[model samples]
Target: MRTTHPHPTNAVEPPIAGTAEARRVSPNAGWWRVIGTVLGIMLLLVAYYWVHKPLDLSLVLRLGGLLLDLAVNIALFVAGGALGRALLASLNWAVVSRGERIAFEALAGLGVISTGALLAGMAGLFRGVFLWLIVAVAFLIAMRRGGGSWLVDARAFTRALRPIDRWARLWGIVACALLAMALARALAPPFAWDALNYHLVGPARYLSEGRIVPAPDNFYLGFPQLLELLFGVAMSAFGRDTVAAPLHFGFGVLGLILVAGLVRRHTDVRAGWLAVALPLSATSFWLLFGWPYVDLAVFAYGAAVLVAAVNWREHRETGWLVVAGVALGFGAGTKYTAGLLAIGLAAMIVVEARSRALRPLLLAGGVA
Candidate 1:
């Protein structure tokens, strides 16, 4: 005690030095966080405008329409969020923490609950508005906390946008081929066999009545309403014009973008371009390219799942695993065949994790 009476004030200052080093290494982290918060608010506002704006309809009909729209939105959110998480995980970005991933999954489950309520159609405008408000809040919170790393990773963001930059010549050829395919598909007759059968007809019926009316003739077929509902909205806007087919093409294009972005995470530009081109070049893909069907949705969701699986493998993040599960669920919901893909992917993940004695696989499987 007597010897310690004259201790220097700087003796215990090393902890502060360590903290300063951390700040220097992650200097822009706070700024990135602030930007994320602002962007989150903007997204919420955009979502509200897109979903809640005035439309030409009676009050009762508008109320009913709101409920239907809410259902579709919730479903897309669950599927999209899951796919996004899996993709991010594959990239090995520690954007989301473990607790954040759990919370995100919980919010996604809540979206399912909201979907059930919206499908019931018993809830009026007030209920719909309340539910949507909760969703917006949850989304904002999740993005702010779980998406920080993504926001800060400017290099990854730039790379995703220009996946073809490294192989410009090859990508140009692929782009031209895709364009030609799109033009051919769009100019073709509207009464393609499937279009006449159920794809367009089912949604056309729904648009006419502003409600989902299943056709007994096609009762054996299972269709996910995500794309159908979108087609219904587009049909309402364009009055069944030939241009509606191009909308499906647009979705396919978006799916291609997602694939490119996902592949770019793990491979070089040439490999990523191949990933995007191979799927589009498939004959089966061209057959369904412009049709108003669920194939594009499946493609999009599948690409998303692949990205997520890669992320989970690289980062071992529980959040990515859960997100992969959600994506799998959404893919399964889109088409029954997708269930097989989901199951196979899940098994692969489980086996890989077990071999390595990784614990996150259990958590991911449970969430998925």
Candidate 2:
């Protein structure tokens, strides 16, 4: 009774409040950044040599053009990325926090833009090594920043690639078959009369212009600029006659790769293989793959949308939903048929979100 109660001397200090310390870059990250910076400089030099030597533009104009090209490319990438992100937000399928999603979208946009520019340059829109350098730098930066793993899970990728793994083996077979078909087409002349009439023709026109413009005379034919624009880049590099067929073949391969990846994500190896094979066997697929029509691009984007939808459904990630919407938008832009898929997907999203009382579903739908 004489001693006062001991003062609470050991009360735990409240843990530091607010946000945690910013994540430190890993040693691996620093190493990658160093490598990227070096590679970027080298590529820039290569670009200088290629653009200035043969093109013979006045020094002032060349500098101006380079700046202009970079500006335009960056703008396009940003716009596409924003549109894609907005679409994902609407669908209630985003995986990361908003801040992380923004970063990821920016990276993805850069990747797509670089891809477009590289393709355009390769097609001969500009005889500059600088464009390639820009693309290389952008791509390297994306990979180093962990953007390369954005769309699909890399951890699962190796397992997906395993030969003994049923899914991997199936995908492998599908890949081989697709390759053989492409080889066959390449060895022969390009098919699908429509390709020659519209797809290749539009790109050839764009390459000649060194810019893009709507071909009003071909009004009945819709032109989605992304792939054609890339084709134009190639034509600039290789000359139209030499590049057109091969470029189409290349795009076809890319489409197949996208499809295979989507299928792999959605189902097991066997199902993925079947999804790929079904498209391969379809007459339309053969026509699209063998010819230079934009259908393959449409298919690729459409499949991407479907895959994004599935991702949204499974994970409740708004980013995925937004991506699906963007993919759908691009698919619709590429071809009218994709609209049906987009409509169906939108309906499903609404129903699912309504059932779950998720706010993101409403947000995603509005964006889409």
Full-model lDDT, candidate 2: 0.54
Tens digit of per-residue lDDT, candidate 2, span 66-95: 344434333333343453343233444233
Clashing pairs in 1: 86-308, 87-307, 87-308, 89-311, 90-310, 90-311
| TM-score, cand. 2 | 0.56
Could you give me the TM-score of model 1 versus the true structure? 0.55
Q: What would the TM-scores of all predictions be? A: 0.55, 0.56
Candidate 1 lDDT tens digits, 1-368: 35565768667633343377667767887788899999999999999879886554686664564344334533434433443343344433344333233223333333353344235222332133443444455445546545334323423443434434657547747865875676566544465776677667765665554456557778633565445544444444334534345545644654565566555555566766676677667777876775656676666556556656776777777666766677666666656776676666667686767776345555555555
Error of 2 at 12 (Å): 99
